[model samples]
Target: MGACDRNCGLLSGAIIGAVLAILGGALIPIGDFLINKTIRKEAAIENGTIAYENWVVPGSPVFRQFFFYHVQNPSEVMNGSRPNLKQIGPYTYRMRYLPKENITQHSDYTVSYFLPNIARFEPDMSVGSENDTFTCINLAVVAAPAMYKSGLVQIFINTLIKSSNSLMLQNRTVKEILWGYVDPFLKKIPFPMERTIGAFYPYNGTTDGLYRVFNGIDDISKTALISSYKNKSTLSLWDGYCDIVNGTDGASFPPFVKKNHVLQFFSSDICRSIFGVFKEERIVKDIPVYRFVVPPAAFASPLVNPDNICFCTEKVLSRNCTSAGALDISACKEGKPVYVTLPHFLFASKDITENIEGLYPDMNEHETFLDVEPTTGFTIHFAKKLQVNLLVTPSSRIETLSKIRQPYLFPVLWLNETAIIGEDKAEMFRSKVSTPIKMLHLLEAVLIIVGAVMFLGFMVSYFICRSKKLK
Candidate 1:
């Protein structure tokens, strides 16, 4: 071949290679930076945005399963014997949140709104009907004496209980036990007391409080985080730092989640903020997620987790503080002796679990966890499991409670509230969020590799042509 032709070929190859290399090198980081910035902007809470629409009304279906504990030997339990308990039906319900109410935008890049909760029983999803009966402790009978301090009031309550033939244990339908039932004794009483009693009596068709959350206009990292609840930044129920409500509402989180970062959210049902730590990576419905779990130390005793000391109240501290894995929520539950723990007492103290006969803690089934998509900070799959227990102690002042027994943390019922991203939403997420990110990464890699090969070929050809001309 002619020297001029060979030299021209080398020059053309070098120019093409240099151009490709420059484009590849410049686009990779710039494209990534721009895409991430766009995501952050889209994730911000603003009117008419996708994030705002989903926040106002979530598209996922939320299911709430209630597992009631039935007492097999109620008489034996009153006489200081360990309660032989049996886990009954899981009466599942489909829960939905209503549209946001009284939405207001503040000057500080925050939005305030109220979201109500509504639940409907799903017979197909449940093991049995809500009409099924179970032998359960009468909460009013056990809690009356502890609620009132006056001796005269206690005597009157005791007399009313006797007159109404109220027993420590009574047969109640699942609906009555969970929703609300008009107690005969409670109706007859004159004091200001709730005549209707149930585990979730006040929750149905109710809003927890007015919520104010950050809109991410000023700071993207603080998006969707709760600024205040019920017009207050702290709760009066808990002490010290426990009173401070610090977290998101669990609907959405800030973008770009890290592996070691703790995910926190405030649950109105539990009346406090809880956090989850990274457990592992998970793949769900062709989507990658970061599985964050409630660490065992979250409800650990003050000895194990000094940060939890503020959770203990004066009454709980007087009794040497609550044991490991038990949270004394009496302050939040209208002064009732109510405590919450993991399902089957998964991480509870040995003494608490040993007192019951039927409990079998299993981490796979009982643990609470959140599977979040790290890029968008969306919780794609999550299950929040919690068991409610009543602290039953023998009261000498009340006749019905004058049983030969010690205090027992009676297992009442447990609930598992779960939700997963629907197929339609998941598909949309893949198309919009996951696919774009993946394509960007794939393009970046391909460009770099192809550009490097072309540049190398150009260098080899240019050197060979120059050597031939010199020869």
Candidate 2:
């Protein structure tokens, strides 16, 4: 009877211990499930909210230039040319985004900026006196064909200053040409003002509603936002415009992605599209970042077209890519055209760069990349590079027209807008996000190991007691 009681007690102890151990083991997976669910919810930006982003362009990289227009064909008065033997830019450009205002419960948003008087022209050597256009190089203003249709011929003719039989520019700066000078007839921005960059006007951000009124005069010269939300998109900023393939947000990706994925986003500046593949997952200043390198194929996305970006760039006088490559925005300047090109002419053939002088195409430095926080889908670090060029085409009717031979896309400037989290914010993220995730992973492994050990220990004790009873 004593042996029976002992055996029975051991059996009861073993049964209870096994059940407890199994439940504890089960908790490992259950805990992980809960943790992931919490993360998805927390990382997701809620709808009806706003988020702000800040970026800065170092002055060392602000490059602007003007190529001298010369006669390639002495027979034709306005034929050929090489740019002035100089470069411009590397000027400091500071940019800030207003809280992206989420309008609807879904992905619709209005992205704006607080433009605190951007220094359009701060007295650079690039500028020349009216006399300099004759001796040195200068950007000549050309009237877009629309100037005639809009009945602005009279105004354009009126605006031209009479010079040595050539209608000359009034010693104006590029900013003065684009945004207008402070004149009685012209409305100049008084100081700091609000400018609308554009919005996700369409429900589908992949292709529509990404542009804003760049210049009030021309519909085609619209400024663009590189990213937007997709249909049924979350309030999370990355979901709408991040993926280059499907519209799904990377932040909403499963906890474990096996391989690199295709990441895409929109860019409205020159009205082009960009897509890249994420190569590796790594830590940036203690934050998890999915780094995407711009592949050569990325420029092929259809969104980077005239229909999407060029309102009428296709018709810009022999400026459109003959290979149907780049969407020329030079025509946007209905008065004088300034063409925009991807940094280093990424997609253009070698001939495009060869034909134009002053274009130092460097793929290594100019390729676009984005470093996004894997879970949050926010752009923490980025270097977006772009180049601006002035289309130098000679028009015979214009008196200011210098005798030029061949038309050239003169490189004016290139800029790099880089962004990174401030040091103070990085520390906060590490404490709040990075440290906690590591702890959860540790806890998960510990639970499984401890549960299995407890089960084995109890089973061994039960068998030993039974053997003794049998003896």
Quick one: best TM-score, which candidate? 1
Alpha-carbon lDDT of model 1: 0.84
Error of 1 at 299 (Å): 0.5
* Alpha-carbon local distance difference test for all models: 0.84, 0.43
What is the C-alpha lDDT profile of model 1 across 1-471, one tens digit per residue? 787877788778767777777777788889879877887777888976657766777758889999999999988876667888899868999887467878889999999998877889999999889899999888888777558767888888888888888877888999999998998878878779679998888778787679999998789899999999999999888878888898898878898999999988998777889999999999988888999999998888888898989887735313777578888787778877888889888898876787789898999999999988898888889999999888777767678677736666788999999999899988988888888888877877777777777778877987887897799
Runs with alpha carbons beyond 4 Å of true place in candidate 2: 1-32, 47-79, 97-140, 143-161, 164-261, 298-325, 330-338, 399-402, 442-471
Check candidate 1 and list the clashing pairs.
Answer: none
Kindly provide the TM-score of model 1 when superposed on the true structure, using C-alpha atoms: 0.91
Lowest lDDT sum, 10 consecutive residues, model 1, at 313-322
Candidate 2 residue 120 Cα shift, in angstroms, is: 10
lDDT of 2 by residue, 147-241 (tens): 33343553354344232222322333333333333332111223453221111111111232222211101111111222233332222212233
Every model's TM-score? 0.91, 0.56
Cα deviation of 164, candidate 1, in Å: 1.5
Query: Cα lDDT for residue 111, model 1?
Result: 94
Cα RMSD (Å) per model? 2.7, 11.2
